[model samples]
Target: MPKPATENLIEFLSNIPFFSEVTKSSLKHLTTVLERETFRKNKLVFEKGSVGEYMYIILSGSVKVHEKNHVFGHMHAGECFGEYALIDSNKRSASITTLEETHVLKIYREHFFQLISNDIGFSQGILSVLIKRHRNIDIIQENLASSKKALELANSKLSGLIDGAMDAIIMFDEKFRILLTNPSASVLFENNDVIQRNLLLFLDESSANRIQNLIKNDLNNDQPLSSNYLPDVIKVIGSHETETLNEGTISKWGDNVTSFYTLILRNIQDRLQAEDKIEFLTSQTEYLKEEIKELTSDHGIIAEDKSMKKVLQLVNKVASTNATVLINGETGTGKELVARAIHQLSDRKDKPLIRINCGAIPTNLIESELFGHEKGAFTGATATRKGRFLLADKGTIFLDEIGELPLELQPKLLRVIQEGEFDPVGSSETIKVDVRIIAATHRDLLQHVQDKKFREDLFYRLNVFPITVPPLRDRGNDICLIADHMIAEFSRELNRPINQLSKEDKAALINYNWPGNVRELQNLIERAIIISQNNSISWQSIIPQGGIEQEATTLQTSNTIYTAPELIEIEKANIERALKRTKWKISGENGAAKLLKLPPTTLASRIKALGIERPI
Candidate 1:
C-alpha cells in the first residue's frame, strides 16, 4: 500500500539536489544508510567549531545558521549542513539551530563518501554546493570588514567622551571583567592596570556582586539604572583613602551582540560627615541635661535623723545587688530621690535611669508608654517608638506611683520584673533586657490587693525588698537640717541674704504638725527667704496657720519652752498617742506611721529620739 514506505523514501532521496540523476537502485542503497531525526523550535543542530562526522539534510521545517552571536543564513526543507564532512573531517565554521519543529535525515561521513564514489552525478552535486558556499562566505567577510570599521569609529568617540568625564567611569563585560577605565576611575582605584580584574576584588563581595548584577540587568533591558547609594564606609583595594557615602549608576552602551556596561560614581563624603557631626551634638545636649539633673538631685536627700539614717543604710546594702526595691512613703517624701540614690550607687550607674509616673499617663496610652509600639500599631502611632523599659536596658527603671498602674496591665509589669523580658504593644517579638527595678508609691498596695483593685501576685513581686522613706515631721532634728539646706539653696537661687532661723521660729516649726511633709517645709522656707529683707529669718515670717498664736499661748502656760527635757516629754506624748492608735504594732500596714501620717522609718526615729519603749 502506498508503494511500501522504504520505496517511497528511496524515491524522495533520488529527487534531492545531492542525489538527483543518480540511479534509483543506488538511491535505494543510500536511503537504507540514512538515519532520520527530528528537532523542535530553537534547538541546536550543531555548534560552531564542533567536529562534524555526519551531514544532515532537513526533511521539514526550517533552520538558522549563525556565526558567534550574529545570524547570517537560513535553510528550509531538503537543505543540508555539514556537507564538508562527506569529503574530509573538519570543524563546522558556523552553528546551525532550528527555527521551528524540524525533521532531518542524517548521512554518516563514511556512508556519504561511499554513495558519492558510486555515483558521478552525486559527487558533482556535492562540489557545486561547496563552491556556492565558498562564494557566500566571501561576501559575508566583506560585510564584516565594513561593520568592524564603523564599530571602531564609534568606540573612538565613546572613549574620548569617557576620558573627558570628571566623575569616575568604568566599562565592564557581562562576566564583571573590567574592559576600560577613564582617568578619574584610574585615580579612584589607585591603579592603572585594572583591565581583566574582577570588580569583586575592589569592594565587598556582596556589594560587588550587587553592582555586577545591576549592570548586567541594565544591559539586558537596554535601560538606564537609578543611582545606588553606598554606606558610610567602603573599602577599596590599594587605596589610602576609603570611600564614604558614594553613589553610582550603570548604563548599556556599544553593540547588541557583545553587550558592554558603563558605571558612573559620585562622592558625597563631605555632606555625610557634616550630618554625623550634627547627630553627635544632639546626643551630647541630651546627655548634658541628665548630668545636670544627677548633680543637683544628689545633694537634696539628708539623713541626720535615726529613722532616715536606717533607710540610708538599707539603701547602701541593696544598691550592691540586683534586687527589686519597693519604696514605701508619702507622695512628697523624696521617694524618687531615694530611687536615684540606689541607681547611682549600683553597678549599672553609668547607664540611664528611666523614670515613668504610672499615674501621669492616660489609661489608653499606658501600654505603649511602658512597652513601646510599632508603627501603625494604633491610630496616632506614626512611627516605631522605644519605651522606658527598653531605654533602661543594663540600668534601672523607676516606676513611680506604681499603685496607680491599671490592674489589667499588672500581669505584664510583673512578668517584666520577674523575667526581665517583655513584648512590645502590637509586636510579636519578645525583647529581653538586663535591668534593676525600683518602684515607689504612696498608696496602701496590700489594702488595694485585699480590695481586688490591685493584683496580689504583682504586689508580692514588687514588695521583694521594701524600703520606707521617713516623713519630715517624725525625722525630729533632721527637719532643721533640711530647713537650713533649703534656705541656703533658695538664698543662692534668689540672690538674698536670709541666712539664720530664730529660736522661736525653730520651736514653732518643731511644735506644728507638718501635714504636707518635706515638700511643704521646703515651700515655706523658700517663701520666707524670698519675703525677708534682713539677714535673719523671723518666726513671724514663716508661721503656719496658727503657729505664732499657739507659740505665745504655750510660752505663757509653761515656764520653759526651749528646755530639752520638756521637748522630749512632749515628743514622747505624741509617740504614745500614735502607738495607742495603731495598737502598738511598729512597722507594718496600719502601723503607728500610718495612723500618725508619718513614714514608718521616720516614726521609728521619733520613738527612739523621744526615749519611748513599747509597754509590756
Candidate 2:
C-alpha cells in the first residue's frame, strides 16, 4: 500500500526548502504545474540579461552560476535557481549552465504567483526560501569581492613576469575576446588596439576553429587548467593583414570567482626560412656530389669517330634552345651520356639533370615515380613526395627507355611536354614545371605506334628533334679511343698501373659486334684492368677463348644472300648457340644475354617468340 505517484511527488516537494511550510494541497498543486526538462553538460539553462519567466529546481546533476564568462558559484541537485524571476519579472542576473547531464523541474512565474495568492503557507514558504537565498547571495558577493581583490594582487605580480617574457602573451575570456596583452603581444600584432577584440579575428579560420574546439573540449571535460603548446605553427594575420607564422601555448587559470585563458606565442617565420635555405643547400650539395662522381667515372664524351662527332654537334646545336630531344639507340649505346651532354651544355647546366629509367621502374609505380604522390594517396604512402619532374624544375629531366612508359600514363606525359603541367598521383591539383625533357629508348617508337602499343600523338610530340646514337660496333675506330680512355681511368681507380690496350686487344675490340654497345665495352675494360698483369691487357684475358674470333669468322664467312625468314632463322640459331654456351643463363656478367650484347628482357622475348626453351 504505497502512496500514489501524485502523493509521493507532493511529499517530495514538501521536503524542499521552497515548499517546507506549504500545505499538502498546495504542494500537490505545485507538482501539477512543474515542468521537467533535461539539459546536456555545458548546455545553457539561461543566459545573463535574458528574460526570465521561470524558476528552475535541479532534480539531478549540477550546474554553475556564471556572469560574463566568470564562474561565481555552483548549484547542485535539490537546489533552485532563477528564483528572483518568479518573484519579480527581471532579466536574469547570472547565467546557469549545466555542469553535467541535468534534469530540472521549472515552475512558471504565473503559477508561482497564483500559488502565493491562494495559499498563505505557500507564500510563507516562498518568502522563507527567498530570504535564505538572499542571505547566501550576500555572503557569496562578499566572498567574491575578497577573491577579486586577491586576484588583482596576483595578476599585478603575474603582469611583471608576463610583460618581461620575450614571447607575446595574451589573456582571453571564454568568448575568445582579448582581455589583456603584454607589450610583446602589441609588438607581435603590430597594433596596440588588440584588446577587447576577438582573438579569432587575428587567426585564420582553421586555426580559429581548432583553438575554439580545444578550449571548449577542455572546459566541458572539467579538465585541470594547465598550459600546453599547440602541435603546429599557426598562421596569424597581423596589422594591415600581414601574415606571419607563430608557435604558441594556451593555458587556462582561474580564481574561485573568475576563469581566464593565456596565450604565449613566438614568431617562427625567420627560423623556418633559414631552415628551408639550409635544406636547399643540403640538396644542392648532394646533387653536386653525384655530378662529381659521374665526371670522375666517365671523362665527358670521347667522340673521335665522325658519327659520334656528328651526334655531339647536334647536341650542341639543340643545347641552347628549349626543345624536346628524342634520342634513338640500342640499349647501352651512350643515350644517357648524350642526354647528360645536352644538359651540361645548356643554360640549365647549373641546375639539375635528373635521370630516370622508365623501363627499370615497376609498371605500377612508374607514374608516381615520375609525377609524385600526396600523403595517404595509397597504401603505405605516409608522406608527400616530390616527383622527378618536379625536382627537375627549371632544369632537365632525362627519361631513359621512354618507349616502355605505360600506355595509361602516356597522355599525362604528353600533357607535360605540350602544356608543361601535370597532376600528381591521387591529386587533382596540377603542378607546372619549367623542365626540359630529353627522352631516349632502344625500341623503335614509330613501330610501337604502328602496332598500337604507343600513342601516335605522344610519339610525334616526343620526336620533335630526333638524334640517333650509333652503336659501339658502328662507332668504328672510336672503340680504340674509348678503350684507351677507360684503361687510363680504371688504371687510376684500381691502382693497377695498366695504361695501354695491346694492338691485338684493340683489333679484337673493333672486330667484335658489340650488341650491348658502349656499356659492355666499359665493363670489359674495367674487368681487363682489374685482372691485367705486367701493366698490359691482352684480348685473350678479357674474352672467352676464341669466342670473339669465332663470331668474327662466322660474320666474315657469311656471304650467301638470305630472305627475311632465313635471316630470322640464322639470328635464332645464333642466340640458341650463345644460350647453350652459357648453360641457358640469360642475364648478369657471364650470362648468354650479356655475351650476345642484348638486354635480358629483349633476349627473353626473342627466346619466347622463337619457341626456345631450356632442355630438361
Candidate 3:
C-alpha cells in the first residue's frame, strides 16, 4: 500500500533545481500525488528490466544505483532518481539498492501525468532530467574509452621497455613466489620456467634470505614506501656466468591485497671501465696545466681565501660556457687576475687576450682606442690598426675598470656584446668578431646604474656569471704567500739576497688592514728587499706609518675627534687643487672631468652641490 504525501513534501520539491521554476500551486497538487515511503537497508527498490512505474526523490539516507553487480553511483538526501522511467514505457535501465534505511517520495506514472497536465513546468522538468542523464552517460562512456586507450598505450610501452631492457627485472609476490620475469631475468635462470616458482630457487641462499626479509618489512609498513633495500653489489647465479650486479634495489608494487616486490639489477662493469679511463686522462691534463701555471708569475690566480676559492670554482664552471662574466672587487683585489684565469681555463686560451683599462684612456681617445680609427680620421691618427675587439678575435677581451666606460660608449658596447658586430671609428663596414668578454670593475656598477651612469641592460649582459674576488684584508694568511712570491721576484730584480721574513716582519704585515690590497703588499715587499742589508727583510722600515693602525692610534691619542666639517674641508681642498691644475676648466682633455674620471655634467653638478667656485 502507498502512503499519502504532505504539504512539507511539496515545499521541499519546490527548492529542487528541476522544479524551482514551477508555481507553488502546481507543486502543492504534486504533493497530493507523491506518497512518502521508507525502505530498509539492503532492500531492492527497483530491478533492471523491471516495468517503469514511479520516480524516486530521496528524503533521507542513501541508495546505491547499479547495473548487475557493478555500482555506478550513489544518491543521498535532496537527490532525485528514476525520472527517466516515468516518461517511457521501457524497462528500468539500472537497479536501485538501498545501502541504509532510506526515506523517499514516490510519484506513480498516472499521478505524475496529472501533475504535468496542470503545469507544463512538470513536463519540462522530466525532459530536463532525461536529457541530463543521457549527457552524463555519454561523458562516462567517453571517459571510459579514453582511459582504456591510455591504459593500453601504457601497457604496450611497459612491455616494450621490459623486453628491450638489458637489466634483469623480476617481480614476485609477498610469499616469494615468482609472478613474472622479463627476458633478462629469465636468462639468469637457465631459460627455466620461473613463473609460480619460489624466488629462493634461483638466487643465492644468503641473497634470497635478505630479499625475503626486505619484502616482509615493506608489506608490514603502513605508510607509502617509495623503495627499499638498495644493495651496492649482489651476486646472482646464472647459467653461463655468475653476474655481479650493481645498483640493485627492491621496490614495492601493486595494491595491498595483490602486492608485489620488483627486483631491479644493473651491471656497471662497462661504466666502471670508462670511469677509470676518464680519471687517467683528467690526471694527465691536470699535470700539464700545473706545469704551465708554475711557469707564470701569479699562476693566473692564488685563491687561498675561502671566498676567493668559491669565486675560482665559479670561474671554472662558467669558463666552459660562452656566457659573459663580470668580476667585481676593490681595486688591487685581483679582479683582472680572476678574469685572466677564466680565459686561461676556457677554450680561447690559444688566442690573444687583449686588455683595456677604461679609466686609463683619455675620454677623447677612448672611442678611437676601443674601435680603431682610420688613418687621418682624427688629429695624430696613426696607420690602420685593429681595435681591442678585433685583436681579441677568436679569444677573450679583459675589460678592466668597466664601470668607468662612458655612457655614450655603453650602447655600442652593448650592441657588440649582443650581436658580435661593431663599426670601427670613421668606418661604416661592420666588423664581426668571436670574442669572449670578461669584464672587471672595482666600482659599484649597480650604484652607477641608479645614477644613470651605467646602462642597466649592459650591466645584465656582463653580469651573466658575476664573481666577486675577496679583498686582501679578507684573504688572511694568503698575504704571506703573496709576499713570499714577491720577495723572490724583487730579490732577483734588485740583486738582493733577501730570502725570508722575520717573525716581527710577518706579524706587522698580518696585523695591518691592507687598504691598498695585494698591490700594496707587493710594493712594501719590494721596498723591504731593497733596504734590507741582511737576508731577512725589515718590516718597520718598508711598511707605512699612515695605514689603518696609525689612524686608530691617532684617534685614540686625540682629545677631540674630527667631524663631517673637517672631512668636507679636506675634500674641498682636493677639489680646489684639481681646479687649479686645469685652470677652472671642467671638461675636455687635462680638465677637471678628465682628471677625476667624471663626466663634465657630473663634475658641474658636484661643483654646484658642493658650492665650489674658482679663485678670483
Top-TM-score structure, candidate number: 2
TM-score of 3: 0.43
Candidate RMSDs in order = 16.1, 13.2, 26.9
Please provide, for model 1 over 1-616, each residue's C-alpha lDDT reduced to its tens digit, 9 standing for 90 to 100: 4698888787777667666656677667777788989999999989988898998888899999998668998999877778777777678889999999999999998887786787676666656756776888999999999989989999999888989887788788877788888998887787889999986577765667677667766666754454444433443444555553456766666665676777776655776778756754454456446445433233458877899999999999999999999999975678988999999999999988888768645689989988888889999999776777877789899998898799999999988988889999989999998889999988889999899999998988889899999777788877777777887888888889675776766777777667557765765676576556567656553455343322333443665444434544665798898888877765557777667765554564356445577676
Per-candidate clash tally? 0, 1, 0
Ranking by lDDT: 2, 1, 3
In model 3, the runs with Cα more than 4 Å from the true position are 1-300, 544-616
Residue-level lDDT tens digits of model 3 in 489-526: 77887888775777776767777777567765764565
Backbone steric clashes in candidate 2, count = 1
- lDDT for each residue of candidate 2 in 1-616, tens digit (9 for 90 to 100): 9999898778777777776777887787788789999999999998989999998888899999999677899999878888778768788888889999999999999998898898787777778877888999999999999999999999998888888988999999888989999998888787999889999888988888878887888777655558888997888888878888899999989864467898889989999999867765665566556445433135568888899999999999999999999999987678878999999999999988887767645688888889989889999889776678887899999998899899999999999999999999989999999999999988889999999999999998889999999988888889888888887887888888974566777777787777557776776677666656688655643443333222223333664444435645787899989989988777668988779876665565466546676677
Deviation of model 2 at 525, angstroms: 1.8
lDDT of each: 0.76, 0.81, 0.75
| Count: clashes, candidate 3 | 0
